[model samples]
Target: MSQNIFIIVCIIFVGLLIIAEYRAAKRLDSGFLKWVAKPAASLAFVLVALTGGALDTTYGCWILIGLVFCLLGDVFLIPTGARTFLAGMGAFAIGHLAYVGAFLSTGPEISGLFLIGSAGMAGFAILALRWLWPNLAEFKWPVTVYSAIIAIMVATSFLAAPGQSSAPNWVVIAGALGFAISDIAVSRDKFITHQFFNKSWGLPLYFGAQLLLASSV
Candidate 1:
Protein backbone atom coordinates (compact mmCIF):
# COMPACT_ATOMS: atom_id res chain seq x y z
CA MET A 1 0.00 0.00 0.00
CA SER A 2 1.05 3.53 -0.59
CA GLN A 3 2.18 5.74 2.31
CA ASN A 4 -0.73 8.08 1.69
CA ILE A 5 -3.22 5.27 1.99
CA PHE A 6 -1.55 4.01 5.14
CA ILE A 7 -1.70 7.45 6.71
CA ILE A 8 -5.36 7.84 5.86
CA VAL A 9 -6.20 4.47 7.35
CA CYS A 10 -4.25 5.24 10.49
CA ILE A 11 -6.09 8.52 10.89
CA ILE A 12 -9.44 6.77 10.61
CA PHE A 13 -8.44 4.27 13.27
CA VAL A 14 -7.31 7.06 15.55
CA GLY A 15 -10.61 8.85 15.12
CA LEU A 16 -12.52 5.70 15.95
CA LEU A 17 -10.43 5.19 19.07
CA ILE A 18 -10.95 8.73 20.27
CA ILE A 19 -14.71 8.41 19.90
CA ALA A 20 -14.77 5.07 21.68
CA GLU A 21 -12.58 6.30 24.48
CA TYR A 22 -14.67 9.43 24.85
CA ARG A 23 -17.75 7.31 25.33
CA ALA A 24 -15.87 5.27 27.87
CA ALA A 25 -14.95 8.47 29.66
CA LYS A 26 -18.63 9.35 29.84
CA ARG A 27 -19.24 5.99 31.55
CA LEU A 28 -21.27 4.76 28.64
CA ASP A 29 -21.64 1.07 27.84
CA SER A 30 -18.88 0.87 25.33
CA GLY A 31 -18.30 -2.86 25.38
CA PHE A 32 -14.79 -3.87 24.42
CA LEU A 33 -14.22 -0.39 23.09
CA LYS A 34 -11.06 0.31 25.02
CA TRP A 35 -9.71 -3.12 24.24
CA VAL A 36 -10.34 -2.70 20.56
CA ALA A 37 -8.92 0.80 20.46
CA LYS A 38 -5.68 -0.07 22.27
CA PRO A 39 -4.69 -2.85 19.93
CA ALA A 40 -5.86 -0.90 16.93
CA ALA A 41 -3.53 1.90 17.98
CA SER A 42 -0.62 -0.51 18.01
CA LEU A 43 -1.72 -2.13 14.79
CA ALA A 44 -1.47 1.24 13.10
CA PHE A 45 2.23 1.20 13.89
CA VAL A 46 2.55 -2.34 12.58
CA LEU A 47 0.99 -1.15 9.36
CA VAL A 48 3.62 1.56 9.13
CA ALA A 49 6.32 -1.01 9.67
CA LEU A 50 4.98 -3.08 6.83
CA THR A 51 4.37 -0.19 4.44
CA GLY A 52 6.91 2.48 5.38
CA GLY A 53 9.68 0.67 3.53
CA ALA A 54 11.98 0.28 6.55
CA LEU A 55 11.33 -3.18 8.01
CA ASP A 56 14.51 -4.70 6.51
CA THR A 57 16.91 -2.39 8.37
CA THR A 58 18.01 -3.03 11.95
CA TYR A 59 16.86 0.42 13.00
CA GLY A 60 13.43 -0.28 11.64
CA CYS A 61 13.32 -3.61 13.44
CA TRP A 62 14.25 -1.96 16.70
CA ILE A 63 11.34 0.46 16.30
CA LEU A 64 9.10 -2.50 15.56
CA ILE A 65 10.21 -4.12 18.80
CA GLY A 66 9.33 -0.95 20.71
CA LEU A 67 5.90 -0.82 19.12
CA VAL A 68 5.28 -4.46 20.03
CA PHE A 69 6.18 -3.75 23.61
CA CYS A 70 3.86 -0.76 23.58
CA LEU A 71 1.09 -3.13 22.45
CA LEU A 72 1.89 -5.38 25.35
CA GLY A 73 1.84 -2.45 27.75
CA ASP A 74 -1.55 -1.38 26.49
CA VAL A 75 -2.99 -4.82 27.03
CA PHE A 76 -1.44 -5.21 30.42
CA LEU A 77 -2.77 -1.86 31.64
CA ILE A 78 -6.32 -2.68 30.58
CA PRO A 79 -6.88 -5.04 33.50
CA THR A 80 -7.51 -3.37 36.84
CA GLY A 81 -4.77 -4.55 39.16
CA ALA A 82 -1.54 -3.29 40.67
CA ARG A 83 0.35 -6.25 39.25
CA THR A 84 -0.98 -5.48 35.82
CA PHE A 85 0.10 -1.88 36.15
CA LEU A 86 3.61 -2.90 37.10
CA ALA A 87 3.70 -5.37 34.25
CA GLY A 88 2.61 -2.67 31.87
CA MET A 89 5.30 -0.38 33.19
CA GLY A 90 7.92 -3.07 32.62
CA ALA A 91 6.76 -3.63 29.08
CA PHE A 92 6.83 0.09 28.32
CA ALA A 93 10.25 0.47 29.92
CA ILE A 94 11.61 -2.21 27.64
CA GLY A 95 9.91 -0.45 24.76
CA HIS A 96 11.57 2.84 25.66
CA LEU A 97 14.96 1.15 25.87
CA ALA A 98 14.37 -0.37 22.48
CA TYR A 99 13.59 3.11 21.16
CA VAL A 100 16.77 4.38 22.77
CA GLY A 101 18.68 1.65 20.98
CA ALA A 102 17.14 2.69 17.71
CA PHE A 103 18.21 6.25 18.36
CA LEU A 104 21.77 5.28 19.25
CA SER A 105 22.02 3.10 16.17
CA THR A 106 21.92 6.27 14.11
CA GLY A 107 25.20 7.34 15.73
CA PRO A 108 23.93 10.84 16.43
CA GLU A 109 26.65 13.36 16.91
CA ILE A 110 26.84 14.75 20.41
CA SER A 111 26.16 18.47 20.42
CA GLY A 112 25.42 21.19 22.95
CA LEU A 113 21.87 21.38 21.69
CA PHE A 114 21.41 17.68 22.29
CA LEU A 115 22.75 17.95 25.81
CA ILE A 116 20.39 20.84 26.48
CA GLY A 117 17.46 18.81 25.32
CA SER A 118 18.53 15.93 27.54
CA ALA A 119 18.75 18.29 30.49
CA GLY A 120 15.31 19.63 29.72
CA MET A 121 13.92 16.15 29.70
CA ALA A 122 15.60 15.40 33.00
CA GLY A 123 14.09 18.53 34.53
CA PHE A 124 10.61 17.54 33.42
CA ALA A 125 11.02 14.11 34.90
CA ILE A 126 12.17 15.59 38.19
CA LEU A 127 9.22 17.96 38.34
CA ALA A 128 6.75 15.18 37.59
CA LEU A 129 8.23 12.99 40.30
CA ARG A 130 8.12 15.78 42.82
CA TRP A 131 4.46 16.40 42.11
CA LEU A 132 3.57 12.75 42.46
CA TRP A 133 5.72 11.99 45.50
CA PRO A 134 3.03 12.58 48.09
CA ASN A 135 0.43 10.41 46.41
CA LEU A 136 2.85 7.80 45.06
CA ALA A 137 3.22 6.13 48.49
CA GLU A 138 4.00 2.52 47.53
CA PHE A 139 4.38 2.92 43.76
CA LYS A 140 6.76 5.86 43.92
CA TRP A 141 9.94 4.08 43.04
CA PRO A 142 8.48 2.07 40.18
CA VAL A 143 6.84 5.12 38.69
CA THR A 144 10.05 7.06 39.04
CA VAL A 145 12.05 4.47 37.16
CA TYR A 146 9.48 4.24 34.41
CA SER A 147 9.22 8.01 34.10
CA ALA A 148 13.00 8.36 33.81
CA ILE A 149 13.13 5.81 31.05
CA ILE A 150 10.34 7.53 29.15
CA ALA A 151 12.06 10.87 29.53
CA ILE A 152 15.16 9.38 28.03
CA MET A 153 13.11 8.03 25.18
CA VAL A 154 11.76 11.50 24.47
CA ALA A 155 15.19 13.09 24.65
CA THR A 156 16.65 10.54 22.29
CA SER A 157 13.83 11.04 19.82
CA PHE A 158 15.23 14.48 19.10
CA LEU A 159 18.64 13.11 18.23
CA ALA A 160 17.61 9.80 16.72
CA ALA A 161 17.67 10.89 13.13
CA PRO A 162 20.95 11.93 11.49
CA GLY A 163 19.93 15.46 10.61
CA GLN A 164 18.30 17.75 13.17
CA SER A 165 16.64 19.92 10.52
CA SER A 166 14.92 17.10 8.68
CA ALA A 167 11.12 16.75 8.66
CA PRO A 168 11.36 13.16 9.89
CA ASN A 169 13.42 14.28 12.88
CA TRP A 170 10.85 16.93 13.87
CA VAL A 171 8.03 14.47 13.42
CA VAL A 172 9.71 11.99 15.76
CA ILE A 173 10.35 14.70 18.32
CA ALA A 174 6.74 15.91 18.18
CA GLY A 175 5.53 12.35 18.67
CA ALA A 176 7.77 11.91 21.68
CA LEU A 177 6.51 15.14 23.22
CA GLY A 178 2.92 14.13 22.59
CA PHE A 179 3.61 10.78 24.26
CA ALA A 180 5.06 12.56 27.24
CA ILE A 181 2.02 14.80 27.60
CA SER A 182 -0.33 11.84 27.31
CA ASP A 183 1.57 10.00 30.02
CA ILE A 184 1.37 13.00 32.31
CA ALA A 185 -2.39 13.02 31.83
CA VAL A 186 -2.47 9.32 32.65
CA SER A 187 -0.46 9.82 35.78
CA ARG A 188 -2.65 12.64 36.94
CA ASP A 189 -5.87 10.74 36.31
CA LYS A 190 -4.65 7.48 37.82
CA PHE A 191 -2.60 8.67 40.78
CA ILE A 192 -3.77 12.12 41.79
CA THR A 193 -7.42 12.21 40.85
CA HIS A 194 -10.08 10.66 38.65
CA GLN A 195 -10.65 13.02 35.80
CA PHE A 196 -12.65 11.70 32.87
CA PHE A 197 -11.64 14.58 30.68
CA ASN A 198 -8.05 13.44 30.88
CA LYS A 199 -8.87 10.64 28.50
CA SER A 200 -10.31 13.13 26.06
CA TRP A 201 -6.94 14.79 25.48
CA GLY A 202 -4.76 11.84 26.40
CA LEU A 203 -6.25 9.36 23.95
CA PRO A 204 -5.79 11.62 20.96
CA LEU A 205 -2.28 12.61 21.99
CA TYR A 206 -1.38 8.98 22.42
CA PHE A 207 -2.75 7.70 19.10
CA GLY A 208 -1.44 10.75 17.29
CA ALA A 209 1.99 10.26 18.79
CA GLN A 210 2.02 6.58 17.90
CA LEU A 211 0.96 7.40 14.35
CA LEU A 212 3.72 9.97 14.01
CA LEU A 213 6.32 7.57 15.37
CA ALA A 214 5.05 4.89 13.04
CA SER A 215 5.48 7.24 10.14
CA SER A 216 9.11 7.66 11.15
CA VAL A 217 9.66 4.11 10.08
Candidate 2:
Protein backbone atom coordinates (compact mmCIF):
# COMPACT_ATOMS: atom_id res chain seq x y z
CA MET A 1 0.00 0.00 0.00
CA SER A 2 2.80 2.38 0.91
CA GLN A 3 4.57 1.47 -2.27
CA ASN A 4 1.50 2.31 -4.26
CA ILE A 5 1.24 5.64 -2.51
CA PHE A 6 4.85 6.43 -3.29
CA ILE A 7 4.31 5.58 -6.95
CA ILE A 8 1.28 7.86 -7.11
CA VAL A 9 3.17 10.73 -5.51
CA CYS A 10 6.05 10.27 -7.86
CA ILE A 11 3.74 10.24 -10.86
CA ILE A 12 2.14 13.47 -9.79
CA PHE A 13 5.51 15.04 -9.13
CA VAL A 14 6.81 13.98 -12.52
CA GLY A 15 3.76 15.38 -14.29
CA LEU A 16 4.19 18.73 -12.57
CA LEU A 17 7.89 18.79 -13.35
CA ILE A 18 7.22 18.07 -17.01
CA ILE A 19 4.75 20.94 -17.17
CA ALA A 20 7.26 23.24 -15.50
CA GLU A 21 9.95 22.14 -17.94
CA TYR A 22 7.76 23.00 -20.92
CA ARG A 23 6.97 26.39 -19.47
CA ALA A 24 10.60 27.04 -18.75
CA ALA A 25 11.70 26.09 -22.23
CA LYS A 26 8.84 27.70 -24.13
CA ARG A 27 7.13 30.46 -22.16
CA LEU A 28 9.35 31.77 -19.38
CA ASP A 29 12.61 30.95 -21.13
CA SER A 30 13.98 30.19 -17.72
CA GLY A 31 17.23 28.27 -17.68
CA PHE A 32 17.01 27.53 -13.98
CA LEU A 33 13.67 25.78 -14.29
CA LYS A 34 14.67 23.93 -17.42
CA TRP A 35 17.84 22.72 -15.77
CA VAL A 36 16.09 21.75 -12.57
CA ALA A 37 12.72 20.47 -13.73
CA LYS A 38 13.81 18.32 -16.66
CA PRO A 39 16.30 16.26 -14.74
CA ALA A 40 13.99 16.19 -11.73
CA ALA A 41 11.26 14.78 -13.94
CA SER A 42 13.58 12.11 -15.23
CA LEU A 43 14.77 11.28 -11.75
CA ALA A 44 11.20 10.90 -10.57
CA PHE A 45 10.72 8.06 -13.04
CA VAL A 46 13.80 6.38 -11.65
CA LEU A 47 12.35 6.69 -8.17
CA VAL A 48 9.09 5.26 -9.43
CA ALA A 49 10.91 2.23 -10.79
CA LEU A 50 12.82 1.76 -7.56
CA THR A 51 9.72 2.07 -5.44
CA GLY A 52 8.06 -0.52 -7.67
CA GLY A 53 10.90 -2.94 -6.88
CA ALA A 54 12.77 -2.61 -10.14
CA LEU A 55 15.92 -4.23 -8.80
CA ASP A 56 14.14 -7.49 -7.98
CA THR A 57 14.31 -8.96 -11.49
CA THR A 58 16.62 -9.02 -14.50
CA TYR A 59 14.13 -7.18 -16.77
CA GLY A 60 13.49 -4.53 -14.17
CA CYS A 61 17.19 -4.02 -13.55
CA TRP A 62 17.82 -3.32 -17.23
CA ILE A 63 14.90 -0.90 -17.32
CA LEU A 64 16.30 0.87 -14.25
CA ILE A 65 19.63 1.23 -16.01
CA GLY A 66 17.90 2.57 -19.12
CA LEU A 67 16.02 5.11 -17.06
CA VAL A 68 19.26 6.27 -15.48
CA PHE A 69 20.88 6.73 -18.86
CA CYS A 70 17.82 8.62 -20.07
CA LEU A 71 18.18 10.85 -17.01
CA LEU A 72 21.74 11.55 -18.03
CA GLY A 73 20.52 12.31 -21.52
CA ASP A 74 18.05 14.81 -20.13
CA VAL A 75 20.82 16.50 -18.20
CA PHE A 76 23.08 16.67 -21.21
CA LEU A 77 20.28 18.23 -23.25
CA ILE A 78 19.64 21.00 -20.72
CA PRO A 79 22.63 22.96 -21.97
CA THR A 80 22.81 24.30 -25.53
CA GLY A 81 25.77 23.21 -27.63
CA ALA A 82 26.62 20.82 -30.40
CA ARG A 83 28.81 18.74 -28.15
CA THR A 84 26.15 18.60 -25.47
CA PHE A 85 23.52 17.59 -28.01
CA LEU A 86 25.77 14.85 -29.29
CA ALA A 87 26.42 13.69 -25.77
CA GLY A 88 22.72 13.67 -25.06
CA MET A 89 22.02 11.65 -28.16
CA GLY A 90 24.71 9.19 -27.18
CA ALA A 91 23.18 8.76 -23.75
CA PHE A 92 19.74 8.17 -25.22
CA ALA A 93 21.17 5.66 -27.66
CA ILE A 94 22.67 3.77 -24.74
CA GLY A 95 19.36 3.94 -22.93
CA HIS A 96 17.59 2.44 -25.97
CA LEU A 97 20.13 -0.38 -26.00
CA ALA A 98 19.43 -1.08 -22.36
CA TYR A 99 15.74 -1.26 -23.14
CA VAL A 100 16.49 -3.66 -25.97
CA GLY A 101 18.40 -5.78 -23.52
CA ALA A 102 15.50 -5.73 -21.14
CA PHE A 103 13.05 -6.82 -23.83
CA LEU A 104 15.33 -9.55 -25.15
CA SER A 105 15.74 -10.91 -21.64
CA THR A 106 12.06 -11.73 -21.68
CA GLY A 107 12.61 -14.67 -24.01
CA PRO A 108 9.72 -13.66 -26.20
CA GLU A 109 8.09 -16.09 -28.57
CA ILE A 110 8.73 -15.67 -32.27
CA SER A 111 5.23 -15.16 -33.51
CA GLY A 112 3.61 -13.63 -36.59
CA LEU A 113 2.84 -10.41 -34.74
CA PHE A 114 6.47 -10.01 -33.84
CA LEU A 115 7.54 -10.38 -37.46
CA ILE A 116 4.95 -7.88 -38.66
CA GLY A 117 5.91 -5.40 -35.99
CA SER A 118 9.58 -5.72 -36.79
CA ALA A 119 8.94 -5.13 -40.45
CA GLY A 120 6.85 -2.07 -39.72
CA MET A 121 9.51 -0.65 -37.45
CA ALA A 122 12.16 -1.25 -40.08
CA GLY A 123 10.10 0.59 -42.68
CA PHE A 124 9.53 3.46 -40.29
CA ALA A 125 13.25 3.74 -39.70
CA ILE A 126 13.93 3.91 -43.41
CA LEU A 127 11.35 6.64 -43.97
CA ALA A 128 12.47 8.62 -40.96
CA LEU A 129 16.09 8.50 -42.11
CA ARG A 130 15.17 9.71 -45.52
CA TRP A 131 13.23 12.61 -44.06
CA LEU A 132 16.03 13.71 -41.73
CA TRP A 133 19.02 13.00 -43.94
CA PRO A 134 19.26 16.40 -45.58
CA ASN A 135 19.26 18.41 -42.37
CA LEU A 136 21.42 16.09 -40.25
CA ALA A 137 24.57 17.96 -41.32
CA GLU A 138 27.67 16.64 -39.59
CA PHE A 139 25.62 14.58 -37.18
CA LYS A 140 24.14 12.49 -39.95
CA TRP A 141 25.92 9.30 -39.10
CA PRO A 142 25.28 9.53 -35.39
CA VAL A 143 21.61 10.23 -35.91
CA THR A 144 21.30 7.34 -38.34
CA VAL A 145 22.90 4.97 -35.89
CA TYR A 146 20.72 6.27 -33.07
CA SER A 147 17.63 5.83 -35.24
CA ALA A 148 18.57 2.24 -35.93
CA ILE A 149 19.08 1.56 -32.23
CA ILE A 150 15.65 2.95 -31.37
CA ALA A 151 14.02 0.97 -34.19
CA ILE A 152 15.54 -2.18 -32.83
CA MET A 153 14.35 -1.24 -29.38
CA VAL A 154 10.81 -0.84 -30.66
CA ALA A 155 11.00 -4.11 -32.57
CA THR A 156 12.15 -5.92 -29.48
CA SER A 157 9.31 -4.40 -27.51
CA PHE A 158 6.92 -6.11 -29.92
CA LEU A 159 8.67 -9.40 -29.30
CA ALA A 160 8.21 -8.90 -25.58
CA ALA A 161 4.51 -8.18 -25.88
CA PRO A 162 3.23 -11.77 -25.95
CA GLY A 163 2.81 -12.10 -22.19
CA GLN A 164 6.40 -13.20 -21.79
CA SER A 165 7.71 -10.00 -20.17
CA SER A 166 7.34 -8.43 -16.75
CA ALA A 167 5.15 -5.71 -18.25
CA PRO A 168 1.72 -6.12 -19.77
CA ASN A 169 1.66 -6.43 -23.55
CA TRP A 170 -0.29 -3.28 -24.09
CA VAL A 171 1.89 -1.29 -21.72
CA VAL A 172 5.05 -2.50 -23.41
CA ILE A 173 3.76 -1.73 -26.89
CA ALA A 174 2.32 1.66 -25.99
CA GLY A 175 5.44 2.78 -24.14
CA ALA A 176 7.72 1.81 -27.01
CA LEU A 177 5.53 3.45 -29.63
CA GLY A 178 5.18 6.62 -27.60
CA PHE A 179 8.90 6.86 -27.03
CA ALA A 180 9.63 6.31 -30.71
CA ILE A 181 7.08 8.86 -31.88
CA SER A 182 8.31 11.42 -29.39
CA ASP A 183 11.76 11.16 -30.90
CA ILE A 184 10.35 12.29 -34.22
CA ALA A 185 9.24 15.49 -32.54
CA VAL A 186 12.67 15.93 -31.04
CA SER A 187 14.33 15.37 -34.38
CA ARG A 188 12.08 17.85 -36.12
CA ASP A 189 12.66 20.47 -33.45
CA LYS A 190 16.42 20.09 -33.51
CA PHE A 191 17.23 19.43 -37.16
CA ILE A 192 14.30 20.80 -39.11
CA THR A 193 12.64 23.63 -37.22
CA HIS A 194 13.35 25.10 -33.82
CA GLN A 195 9.91 25.65 -32.36
CA PHE A 196 7.90 25.28 -29.18
CA PHE A 197 5.27 23.30 -31.02
CA ASN A 198 7.55 20.30 -30.96
CA LYS A 199 7.95 20.35 -27.19
CA SER A 200 4.24 20.79 -26.69
CA TRP A 201 3.61 17.24 -27.81
CA GLY A 202 7.01 15.63 -27.42
CA LEU A 203 7.55 16.35 -23.74
CA PRO A 204 4.25 14.86 -22.67
CA LEU A 205 4.65 11.80 -24.84
CA TYR A 206 8.23 11.24 -23.73
CA PHE A 207 7.50 11.60 -20.02
CA GLY A 208 4.38 9.51 -20.28
CA ALA A 209 6.30 6.77 -22.03
CA GLN A 210 8.94 6.79 -19.31
CA LEU A 211 6.29 6.67 -16.63
CA LEU A 212 4.61 3.72 -18.30
CA LEU A 213 7.89 1.86 -18.51
CA ALA A 214 8.60 2.63 -14.86
CA SER A 215 5.20 1.33 -13.87
CA SER A 216 5.98 -1.91 -15.64
CA VAL A 217 8.55 -2.63 -12.96
- Which candidate tops lDDT? 2
Candidate 2: clashing pairs of residues: none
C-alpha displacement of 109 in model 2, angstroms? 1.9
* lDDT per residue (tens digit) for residues 79-173 in model 2: 76999999999999999999998888877777777788889999999999999999999989999999899999988887664234344377877
Candidate 2, position 107, lDDT: 77
Candidate-wise lDDT, in order: 0.79, 0.82
Model 2 weakest 10-residue run by lDDT? 159-168
Best of the candidates, TM-score: 1
In candidate 1, residue 133 scores what lDDT? 90
* TM-score of every candidate: 0.90, 0.89
Q: Write one digit per residue (lDDT tens) for candidate 1, span 1-217.
A: 7766766676676677767767766788664876786677677676776687557666677787887888898789877688998898899899889888887777777766678878999999999999989998889999999989999998888777833333227777888888888998878877998666777788778767877777777
